[model samples]
Target: MTVAADAPPLRRPTRLAYGFGSVADGIKSAAFSTYLLLYFNQVLGVKASVVSTAIALTLLVDAVVDPLIGRMSDLTRSKYGRRHPYIFAAAVPAAFFFGMTWFPPAGLSDFAMGVWIFGFAAFARASMSMYQVPANALGSELTQDYAERSRIYGLRYWFAYAGTFAFAAFALKFFFVATPEYPKGQLNPAGYVPFAITAASLIFISILVCGWGTRSRIPYIRQADEREASPGLLSHFKEMGVAFKNRGFLTVFGFAILKWTAIGLYGATSLYFGTYVYQLSSGQLALLTLDSFVAVCIALPLAPKVTKWFGKRNTSLWMALIGITLGTSPLWLTYFDLFFPPGHPLLLPTLLLIGAVYGTMVALSLMMTAAMLADVVEDDAVTSGKHNAGIYFAASSFATQCASGLGILAAGFVLETSQFPGGVDPALVTEAMTDSLIAHYVPMVMGLWAIGCLIIWFYPIDEAKHLANVERLRAREAEAKARDMQDAPLGAPAR
Candidate 1:
């Protein structure tokens, strides 16, 4: 929550280390979101509904796993500290399962393939939660400065988006390539093995690098209170209830759900839109992925300044509005034939321009939200008498997973309803089917994002309020410390 005015400032290397760690997260997200459904339904010949259902069912496990990991990490005391231990332990297995998800086996039935996806996805999701929940909590622990938190998250997201861009480009350019039999590189089954290995390697290495890099901060990070009792199963639930009582946490949590649900829909369908509706090749897709890199390069420097100018809440609201406008407008225009026709030279550029704007907005909004959530930790501590950043972030993670599952489910439903059969060539996809897909996608994305923006508009934590909360918390801590000193034996050293 709050730190004393004399608290140590975060060093540049430490911040960069934390930021670079998210490359693992980026690779996982990009590989899963962009290629998972396509790999299963299109290449592996699993039904769309089956693949989405498997993903959704597995993610439900997060409702239990995420908070449990958060609470356990909060109470954990070890030489390596609460967060890093889990972070380090999770990396290898997470990488193994992530790789396995792509390489199920040859000649499996649809039901068997679905079962394989579920098993591997469940493990991958669990491993990711182990690292991600605590890693995010560590960010809140790393700094108490308001603007500095924004900068930290900016670096984090910059690395995340950059990694995603690299993975996307690499997958399109090298892993997946057009062949005489498989015109679209992504539909080629053989390439997935190398792609999986590459992504898994990145995930493993980045997690270790981030964990080791931030190891020095363990001494400074908040420790478990000796006075507090160990959390029981009921206690974990009670703690979650207390976290939900914080209005600021709820605002961010709800916003994340809606925002990420929209993201889920977009991610699930993006490859489909690009391949079928826009008829983009692997090279064109690679070019489009560059939008994230360009956006982050521009946004990373500007995010903190803009947050200072507009405040995190307002900045996020504006960015969301702008993003929603940019993201959906092109689709609508193209759908109505108001933009260039599908095969026109301008179509790809137009879509790329939209991607650039939307990407920038996403970078800005994510940075603001992460910082805003960190601010809530102190406010939560003031009531609960302990900093539980892990739990709060875990709750956010739960929302994200649920939103992602729901979004993917919706995408699958849309595909099935549109009669977009599995294993069909993109060239055989009917114009009517593409139109129906966009028809389902546009309203779902726009409506969810609009609702999320509306919810965020009511977030109560501004800079002034956050600073006041921090001051109050510091005063409380000082008073408690003084009380402890007075109660100690005369010869005992001060705490």
Candidate 2:
């Protein structure tokens, strides 16, 4: 559908405001992915299997709620606009529930704790989905230029990485620092409360600022076609069907599922790998948090240029390959003592360098994938005669949730089967347990990322195909406008 006006090219300020919103996402993701399982299983003495199952169930809930929110936003005709209303509304609840996930009541049984985890996790994830699905859809609505879209997403990824880096560093340095009672800061139960509060406050402020900053663009944003009847339930399902049929959407969707599953596994296991496998202290771990910040500084500027040179799909595939190699090689070397011994002074610095390289690849790959998805938005509009960015993004979100859920579930099974104990000291972790962690971690992460790279190779849309699609869509819209003018009543104003 045509917008109310020719949408202006996104200004640098607007791009920055939009990108800033991702800091909230980055904070929530860092907290949930990196620390949730560790906090519940190790700090609170809940079983790893129980925490994993609870999170997996919550993600399953998101699989339903995410798309519904997207479809609702797609059809919504509120005065404040389709996306911003939900984006603003989600801030408080998302933050509140997220905080609650970290602060369960004292003296609960394992079952009760699991129940509490499930309830809070579900609400927290759903609230974020309410915002994230629409915010992502809004990115496609912001601009139509292909190269410009890459730049926009590059900015978003940079902000996201920076935010994650800041949060991790802060937590490691201040909240989770080693104490007399708890040698590893992460094992301390007291630090999590302040961590939750800080993260929640940031989530609230970032979302509100983004919502307010972009409010002026409401006039230029696309609205539902007034001429068409309001969609019924069946029609909403039909819209989802149409979105899934687009080959470009499927390409991105499939790749994201595999890639995110790998990421989910990595996030779930990173604490264990760092603490037990590599024997890193909280202080040393904090130093490693700088990797993403360095990557963003290097990769954000390079993303658009690389996309211009190799095309989005090719760039994404190559970057994923490189990322998997860089991310996994250090671990393999450490395991086999191929390089410096694991406890050697130089090993941490060498690992940090590898992390930096991997992080840069990850940032570039994500930037390309987001840009590729924006291209698919235009392709969908051309083929379906509807701009269903929300629906498309929601489907992608669904895949992401599903992948993360399965990954958590698999992690739980591995932990239980390997007989990993809860509330244990890092020094007490057995060699067999480290081997189990490595076996589960390496294959899931490296293999799935490799598979994602392969899947992305078949993505049909290229720069040429996307530009052709945009032209065809412009012609179709022009023809529709002409027909509308011709059919207007004698005294009525033409739409």
Candidate 3:
């Protein structure tokens, strides 16, 4: 049955209903977030240094455009509403070009290749921005109940990770492994297009799933506001500024930035470790599928309990610590390969546990942070006498882009220094390059996550404060509705 607006938020049908599309969303995001930079260097034959510069520059560009886009979305008007139209519009283009980005072409010098990458990548990211910003912002606006907000966000993110983790685990080998011509590597014709096509298909399909599943449930809340405000563009911009002024909102932004930077660094290294250092075949890389699955298994069920015990803020902090400690094992475990064959001595077991804890934390971050952003929006509504969900969520999304930008730039730079490909034959990675990669390049990433942990350690907001705010807002809303009832003109009744 259709439910009342104030009904308690958590329900299995909704959870199940959201899962398919959410997973698809995750796969699309995970592919771009995790793979594209390395693909540009190793497959498209763009030099690591040039690719690094191009990505870093693009990140800066997105950083510039992100919040503005969010503001624009808030002001957007169409028959379909503020968010969905853009999401639907972005899907096909995002799919086609994402594949195109991966396709390698012949006869281009590094200069022309760099220009091509710059133009296509900018468009690719812009297209994704068109969708992802609203998708995340919409999470908070889905319901007003605090717990329901948590449930919706938790389900959304759990599915997101499921898709991302599962995709990362196998998509690499699924497309490129069977084809041998890519062994030439570094922008070879065989390697680029095939990999691009595979990634594009996954991204396009995943977005469609999200577009389909969320259609019935999502409300066009922005369209429903009885009294709209401001000069459209300026209104969105001003609202974004207002949202950013909130201290609580800023804390969520820090976590998003630091946490994702940590994740990005890991994705960049995972390929190097799996392919170059561990000397795993593309087939072996498929084992990552298990790595992500185990993590999701642990997190999905345990999320509520973890948040209940530790509370969201402390829970996030504790999970980060756990990840920092457990995640380091993979690096040192490299030594164990000597005693046991190439397979992980404690690899599966270790990843399994880490994945569980990591997944829990990842989902928690997605849920709690999104919920918190919504609360911050509420704070404004209570203070300003208006409902402004879009602007608040947009700023939150803007902060996310900044975080992604830093992570991508960090990845491009670290890889640039390793003397890859042109310097060392793909036929055999130099012992020196391999050693340098493991000893220097790889270990440094753990430090990045560790630093991310440290930054998140100081994040604001607690369960007590959040609940108190919820109570205050609820009371205020009741009072506002009562006044409306008293002031009703004839048949107007209470809204």
RMSD of 1: 2.0
Superposed on all Cα atoms, model 2 deviates from the true structure by an RMSD in Å of: 1.8
Off by over 4 Å in 2: 227-230, 483-495
Clashing pairs in 2: none
Q: What is the Å distance of residue 92 in model 3 from its true position?
A: 2.7
Residues 144-234, model 3: lDDT tens digits: 6656666666677767776777666555555545445555232244544565566677667766666665665444344434234235656
Clashing pairs in model 1, backbone N/Cα/C closer than 3 A: 1-378
Clashes in each model (backbone N, CA, C under 3 Å)? 1, 0, 6
Q: How do all the candidates rank in terms of lDDT, highest first?
A: 1, 2, 3
User: Which 10-residue window in model 1 sums to the lowest lDDT?
Assistant: 1-10
What would you estimate as the lDDT of candidate 3?
0.61
**Best of the two (1, 2) by lDDT:** 1
- What is the Cα-based lDDT of residue 292 in candidate 3? 64
Model 3 pairs in collision: 43-187, 44-187, 45-187, 103-193, 169-289, 295-355
Best by lDDT: 1
Residue-wise C-alpha lDDT for candidate 1, range 1-495, written one tens digit per residue: 222223466788888889999998888777777789998899878899999998888877899999999988888876677789999999989999998998777899888988998899889989999999999899998887888899988999888886788778878899888999888887898888899998899999889888988987887776665444376799889987788899999899989999988888888888898888888888888888877778887889989899889999998988988888888887787778777766789888888888888888877998899899999998888777878998999998889888888888888988888777788888788878878888878987889988999999888999998899888877887886777789989999654
How do all models score by TM-score? Answer: 0.96, 0.95, 0.84
